[model samples]
Target: MTTNAQQQLQRYLRNARYEVLPLRGVVEQVRELPAGTTVTVTSSPAKGTEATLDTAARLRDEGMHVVPHLAARLVRDSAHLSDLLARVSDLGLTEVFVIAGDAERPAGRFTDALSLLRGMEEIGTRPYRLGITGYPEQHAFIPDRMTIQATDEKARYADYIVSQICYDPNTIASWVKSMRARGVELPVYIGAPGSIDPSKLLRISMKIGLGQSMRFLRKQHGVVTKLLTRYTPENVFDELSPCLVDPDYNIAGWHLFTFNEISKTRQWAIEMADRLQEVPA
Candidate 1:
């Protein structure tokens, strides 16, 4: 590889972060990560917002910087938001990721990420950093225009944007450019799946769509010798290397979706970091 390209790739890997679902045993999985690694725990309808906070608290106690997803729809009102923020402050958290959440109905007045972000300031202790979501590909339910508008609105309140998982590197690269054209300049954390079982990834891709399934297969062709075996993010990272460090893109780093496969993902990250260090940059 060219020296410039190799240097960019190394920079991206060095700043990589991971996202984890709030599921059972997830805390133990997170303990495997190196101390100081930034971990963002996701909130889901199944696990609830408390689960996300609980996981983040554990990670914090483990000496890692934790960014918990505080889903707006799940929060009941200003009182609830205040309590959550106080808890976060007590834990010494400096960052959070806000989302509209997957709940079918809002639990209180705040229904979107922007509303919640505004509420965050009202709580008296604002996190040092806040993140909102971006979608490179169209969201499953929301229209493209609406999503763009929401992003633009939320960007004002957010320090950064974590993109929804998109498999195609070219699509991600183009989307980042479009975001800048639309005047949203928040640094983007590109989301990619970690070292997950191929079968699980396929099931998820199929649920997303046949087109995404095909793209996943094609993208993994270079990384997975056998289709049903374990899959890593090497191909996606390699393909995205250039855009990741390009000044025009305003790219930050990775938000690896570990899917609770933290052990394998952590090992893969270590191996990749070692390999990058061995390279003559």
Candidate 2:
């Protein structure tokens, strides 16, 4: 018989958003997703906000629900912010994910996600659904207390939270519980890496400053060996599925970091969702 948790996992997999980069051939890869899929375009300091916005627009035109990342540090000032928002509006996009970003220094007046949120509000134009980043584990540079405080403040402007990629289910659950206890009740989308090569995953994880999660990944002896081949989030799903059905977690759904491996990730998601449905119920 199919367990309730299994059914929940299936549903989440089906509805989960696929996060993609603004790299070459990404739009074509995303086109393979089922109609109406929600695809989020990530911002890269190397590529600039224009790349993110342009890719998002292309995906939107292709009939996908597109949410582009608006890295605060990439935005120059209020004028720049307004221009971006106008572009989003022109594209008919209703959602965006805001982050402090990976930029070493602020490009303009907005230094952080919270400041960017305020800037959006000041502009008197904003997406209907706004997402902000959350940290299940301690950030590499920001103190835990400060992250918490920032989230609490950003909650006023954000419609939801997408956690930074985390490998530990316990940590994610605990963080969600803590957020609730602290009265920040926005629905959370758990971030998990899509099916990808382990070496690539590690390199990207390190590049993004996932220090604690990298340590956790390193400590998994068996998983480390598997790194010679490929890595899948199957283990992560198996351990975290139970939390999906629990009301306390309020997990909106998975936010699969496809890392531009859309074909492989989409196939895995489809197969998993199918497997769940085929189970006796």
* 1-281 per-residue lDDT for model 1 (tens digits): 67776666665666578888888788888888779989999887788888888889988999888999999999999999988888888888989999998888999999989899888777765688998989887777778899889999899888999988777788788899999998899999988888888878877665554364355666666542365364568867878877876788988888888888988887777688778778776
TM-score (C-alpha, index-matched) for candidate 2: 0.94
Taking every candidate in turn, the Cα RMSD to the unseen true structure, in Å, is 3.0, 1.8
Off by over 4 Å in 1: 1-5, 121-125, 206-231, 277-281
Given candidate 2, what's the lDDT at residue 276?
84
Write one digit per residue (lDDT tens) for candidate 2, span 182-277: 998899998899987777887878767887776676677456445525557776777887777788888898999998999888888888899888
Query: Could you tell me which 10 consecutive residues in candidate 2 have the lowest summed lDDT?
Result: 221-230
TM-score computed on alpha carbons, candidate 1: 0.88
